[model samples]
Target: MTEEKYAGKNKPALSQSGVRWLWLAALVFLADIGIKFLVLDRIGYGWGNRIEILPFFNLLHVHNYGAAFSFLGDQAGWQRWFFTGIAVAVSLMLVFWMSKLPAREKWNNSAYALIIGGAIGNLFDRLVHGFVVDYLDFFWGSYHWPAFNLADSAICIGAVMIILDGFRSKPE
Candidate 1:
């Protein structure tokens, strides 16, 4: 048992490669928040009304009071705390995972960072406003896609990166 403990302690922490990936996660988080403030806030929520960019896309503004698809939006009022707790927990786990990655696995670190950043962004909103502000509408004809914000987009992108990384060869 003592030998096993000593072995664990001797293991090197995240190498330079791993730190770089973690930085990428931080960058993604900053970018997500920056875009929201520069574009969404400047334009003002619900101010654009509707600007059609294509047959299936439009820029609109909307605030979300609940989870995806506004889930639990109408609930008594516990969801705000519930979602907030979950996001915080997830963010912590992602960061912890990023720190443990091998030095050569930059892509994996980046993916984890993206996820952490996005989750934190939304978590910020939940903590401050009791809801997240969402504004990005995509649709075709009468069908309407759920409105989402920069944080949501980042999370999705990160998820894709993670999936892609899984197919790549791991460092020896």
Candidate 2:
């Protein structure tokens, strides 16, 4: 039994290629920051300063000082630093996890990369502007969804990928 345990101990892994995915994360970050900059340059900031795109869509500039859907946006102001610290910690953990992931697990790594990129993007906003820039808007009738940007979309997509990966991991 002891010999059996040691027999395969030195065997190498099937794949160790998560490092390549970091580029994907970087791309996400660049895209997010770039679009945000474009929005800032074009639309600037204000409520009545929006341009109508579709009947239900408008390119508006709104700053979110809190988490998703402006969770603590109305807080006394400590939430900004709190969310920034959380993002940093989460991003570091994701990078570490991505590094340790097997290269064969592309979906897993992609999810991690997207999440890391999104986290960094928002963290940058928190550090520089003290809030996140949201532009995209959707509405039906008088009801409206909270505005969001590319980073937020990427994060949501990545979360969906995580759920799909979980579904695919079950034994066949």
Candidate 3:
């Protein structure tokens, strides 16, 4: 909680100028989809088809029918709509949240924008392809991290920023 004096600056004021952040969000979203398009067009879907860039890094094509880490990926297919709905709702909430931030709060705006963009990108895939396209792959010896894409990266960064924003907004 913030003290009264500090709370004023942190309050959600519903400013109209917050729309500017939407541009960044759109850019992020478009870029994510664009990369997916390139991957799908250029790379074969075979499991063994991947480009190794380093000892632990690769660009591979994958599809996630579930949420993060392929959780619920084995369900009877309801997860497509389920996760899509969640992403849609979260994206809307983030936009509203952005609209309430102070117009000059660039960091907070950027954070919200990134989350919204990532959400929209994944949601689009769920609706159109019934799965989210993933390409980036990392591994260590026999353990491999789940494949992911830019949207996932953006969402993670945004989530961290939001957490940082919380600490920064605390009363001094």
RMSD of each: 4.1, 4.5, 3.0
Best by lDDT: 3
Local accuracy of candidate 3 as per-residue lDDT tens digits, 114-149: 999999999989988999999999999988999999
List clashing residue pairs in candidate 2: none
Better of 1 and 2 by TM-score: 2
* Candidate 1, 42-88: lDDT as tens digits: 55567357667788887766667788778888888799899888888
Off by over 4 Å in 2: 1-15, 170-172
* Cα deviation of 69, candidate 2, in Å: 0.5
| lDDT of model number 2 | 0.81
- Give the TM-score (vs. native) of candidate 1: 0.79
TM-score attained by model 2: 0.86
Error of 1 at 52 (Å): 2.3
CA-lDDT, candidates in order: 0.72, 0.81, 0.85
Q: Determine which window of 10 residues in candidate 1 has minimal summed lDDT.
A: 1-10
In candidate 3, stretches whose alpha carbon ends up further than 4 angstroms from where it belongs are: 1-16, 169-172
Write one digit per residue (lDDT tens) for candidate 2, span 1-172.
Answer: 1343225453224245565677777888999999899888899687688888999998888899988899999998899999988988987887766655556567878998998888888888889999999988888987889898888888888889988886674433
- Runs in model 1 with CA error above 4 Å? 1-11, 14-19, 38-48, 164-172
Give lDDT: candidate 1, residue 19: 51
Task: State the number of backbone clashes in model 1.
Answer: 1
